[model samples]
Target chain A: MQELGSFLEVLISGLLAGVLYSLVALGFVLIFKASGVFNFAQGAMVLLAGLALVRALDFLTRLGFPGWLAIMLGFVFAALVMALCAFLVQRYVLGPLINQNALTMFMATIGATFVIEGVAQFVFGSEVYPLRLFPTDAWIAAEATFPGGILINKLDVWGGVIAGLLVIALALFFQYTKTGRALRAVADDHAAAQSVGIPIDWIWFVVWLVAGLVALVAAAIWGTKLGVQFSITFLALKALPVLIIGGFTSVPGAIIGGLIVGAGEKVAEVYLGPFIGGGIEYWFAYVLALAVLMVRPQGLYGEKIIERI
Target chain B: MGQFKTSYAKDMVIFPIRQDRIGVYLLLGFALVLLPLMMAFHVPPFRTDYFLLAILLPFLILSLAAIGVNILVGYCGQISLGSGAFMAIGAYMAYKFGTGISEIGLPPLPIVFAILLGGLSAAFFGVLFGLPSLRIKGLYLAVATLAAQFFFDWVFLRVKWFTNYAPSGSVSAPELKFFGYLVATPVEKYMVALIFVIVFALIAKNLVRGNIGRQWMAIRDMDIAAELMGIRPLVAKLSAFAVSSFIIGVAGALWAFLRLGTWEPLAFDINRSLELLFMVIIGGLGSILGSFLGAAFILIVPIFLTVLPAELGIPITTGTVSHLQNVIFGGMICCILIKEPLGFARLWQIGKEKLRMWPFPY
Candidate 1:
């Protein structure tokens, strides 16, 4: 019973961590669905957004702004930075190479990743900063008559709730908005959408902005949890396995995949890590995703790929 | 503009044109005579700058690895981000075989034999990781291969047997001997690397031009169509993986033994894989010459960046230099992709064509 209780606690924490992973994966799904380009720079964007927010908050607080106002301004600044990034990416990258092969576009994004990371490090400086969105001393726990009590970090719970809200907000945005429908139309058929007088470029810019906003939220939550640092970029890589496990085009798939990967890695680390000298969490998600990929090439909920010669 | 070949034999040679053959011979002659010529001439930079010689061996090794990656990504159209893992396997395996550190009391093998064995070991792992390629492809295949990178990193770092129970998880190269001569000096190392580069590059060139190369290319262009045309995807894809890994493995052995001499698992991390991929992309995909060009670009640019600020009478911190290098390198890659996706190899071809059409308006 004690073991089971501890397991439940670990599982709960893992599920919360998975919510943040879902947030990052959400950015990838939005961009991929709208643009048909896998944005490798999303990781760098996360780092950039977090760095921007942290620096802005620090600056605003230094200027005698109240804590709440400073935090709000920081978020506003992050949103603006993301909007600028979307504009720049569309203007400089996607605009010129509009009809290139997917591989070429992928490579271009890698180049953009390097550029973004360099710029972020240069501008923000490579120092770990504490981004305390919530008080660190607070804990939320369920009172249960187990051998040891289960303790949950309130920050993690809040992260999960906010992430859930963001996912719902995005889903509704895509479902109800006219712009969202047009975006879907463009994703379904680029040329057909263009012929119908829908501005493809404008839709792309909007999608990138949405992805950028998602990146900001992910970065904020993740950065607050584990101090804003360069290593936060790697957390974005953790989302790739999630993206693969969930379908690349499906938003819900990203959420489910993140939860599975997060919980799976935690469980494996707790149970199987001892036998394997621990640190198996690094590759467990990937191995699991690979196994699933072998069975379903398009992924669990990905649209079926059709190829005609 | 050029002499016509009278016989099919003359036309069938690797370099049919007399001038083209002469150019290649001259290039080889220059490479063979370079060190001796520098020594005789008492060249100040060559004598004083150890960095120049030091960079050469790794450049050659990385070029060879780039060729391996080119085979998979460029020829077979299968993107693999696990080249570093194959390299790690090669390096560790070579260390084991050369040092006789295995469970079996194996005699210390010759350096060449050990390196080949190391390459074979990497090839074995390559085939194992490549099993998913039969089912998945493109970016999916890339992620699958990434599993190899992470798994091997964990193995080399955690498994003490691979490191011979070294406390630091680092290994030094065993003495490299070839035909009773110890390869220790920079010149000797350069010669070893050069010979390997030439031999393997020729092999890659021939492989890509021949029947098997065509089969790999067919699979690359369209696997289903290739399969329909009686070409086996299994054979083509696996062989590409095998051959590519073998070459990459040998390059890894050279990198450990000839270049670094003492190294840890971190040397062949994901960053190294990305750098190798960048070399292939910048050099030219599906072109052997592009590998060399790309390697030269990747290797020399950093040196140039490092030296430029110092020469310009400006004092700059190393951190700032590296930051600037990253920005410039990233911008260059983006520019290259947007402007000339074919990369430097295609530019060279165009230059050659222009030269051939010199003195004519057309």
Candidate 2:
């Protein structure tokens, strides 16, 4: 029973962490569906966004501004930086090589990733900066229901709430707005979207901007857990496994995939890690994703790939 | 610039222009005779151990690895991110062959044969990992190959027997013995690497121009059309993975034995994979000469960047230098991908074409 209680706690925390993964995965799905570029630089963008926000917040705080105002202004400044990044990427990096092969596009994004990582680190000191946006404590509840009270991290719960809100907001944005419908049209068929008078370039820019914003929001919450540092970029690697499991194109898939990965890896790390040595989660997630990939090449929620000669 | 071939044999000649033939002969002569003499005689600053060990040795092996990568990615159209895994397999397997045979009654395998066997073992794993390429395509396949990268990385780190139970989980190269001759000096190591690189490169160059090469290219360009034309995707794709892994495996052995001499799994990590991919991309996909050009570019740019700043008496921190290097390196890759996807190979071909047509503008 104690084991079961601990497992549930682990599972809950994993699910919470997984929701944040879904948040990052959301940004990737946006760019990939719209651009077919994969945007390997998405992780670097998060690092850049996080650094910009933290550095700005630090400066504002040092100037003796009120806490709320500093946070608000910092977020605004970060969003502007992201918008500028979106414009540069869409216009300069991805625009010229529009019809090139997928490999070329992928490589270009990786190049962009290196540049972003380097410049971001160079500008903002490569040291960790703690952001107290969320509670760093834990809560003990349901003590009578489970042995020794199921422990829960307050930060994880709050992060989950924020990630959930962002996902809902994004879902609404993608489903209802006129621009959202146009983005879908562009994703469906680029040439057709252009022929129908949809501004393909504008739609692409909007998608990139939205993707950048998603990363920034997630970075805000995640900054509290891991601290804003260069290691924040590794979140992108974790997101890739979630991506394959959830299917590349589906929003809901990202959530479900994140939950599975977060819970699955957390559980495996505690239980399965001991006998065969620890630190299996990294490759365990990949192996799980590969198994899923072998069974369903497209993914659980990804669109069926149709081929014509 | 002009097609003046009278026969099929003439059309298929390695060098179509007279100057190209003379240029290659002169370059080979310099590498073979002049360079070695300069090194042995300690001629100026060109023949130091640092020059041989740090620059040229790695240049030869990395260029070879780039060709290996080009065969799969550039020619075969099957993208793989598990190249570092294949390299690890080659390095570790070759190390095992060198030391493990004597654990039983048999004598240890010769180093040269161990290297070849290492390549073969890597090829075997390559085929194993390449299995997914049959069903997966494009970016999906690229991600799937990550399975290979992460899996082998774990295997080498955890599996004790592969490392001959070294305490540090790292292994050192055994003797570089060849036919009762010890290849001890850096110069000797460079020569050995040069010989292997030249042989394998020629083989790669010849193979890419043959029927199998055409099949791989066909599969790359349009798989469905190639399938319709009776070019079996399985054979072409697997064969590509096999050949590419073999070449890469040999390069890996050379890298471990000749370049580092003592190394850990960290030596062939994800960064190495990215570096090799950069070489292939910046050099030009599907162009063998581009492999050498790309390797040289990727390898030398940092040295040049670091040195040029110091030479100019600009006192910059190493961190800042590295950051600037990253910006420049990555920007170069993006520019190359956008402006010239064919990369340095295209630039070289254009230069040659211009030279061929110098006397006549049109």
> If scored against the real structure, what TM-score would every candidate get?
0.97, 0.97
Model 2 agreement with the true structure over A168-202: per-residue lDDT tens digits: 89889889999999988888888888899998778
In model 1, the Cα lDDT at residue A126 comes to 78
Q: Which tens-of-lDDT digit does each residue in B1-362 have in candidate 1?
A: 67788898777777766777899989888777876477446686677437446577778899999999999988998888899999999999999999885478798788999999999999999998998999888778878988889889889999999888999889999988987899877877888988999999999998998889999999988899999999999999999999999999999999999898999999999888988888888888888889999888988878887788789988877777666767776777888888887788889888878888887949
Flag regions of model 1 displaced more than 4 Å: A138-140, B5-12
Per-residue error at B68 for model 1, in Å?
0.8
Residue A17, candidate 2: Cα error in Å is 2.0
RMSD per model, one decimal = 1.6, 1.6
DockQ of candidate 1, scored on C-alphas against the true complex (2 decimals): 0.68
Each prediction's DockQ against the real complex: 0.68, 0.74
Q: Give the lowest summed-lDDT range of ten residues in model 1 chain B.
A: B45-54
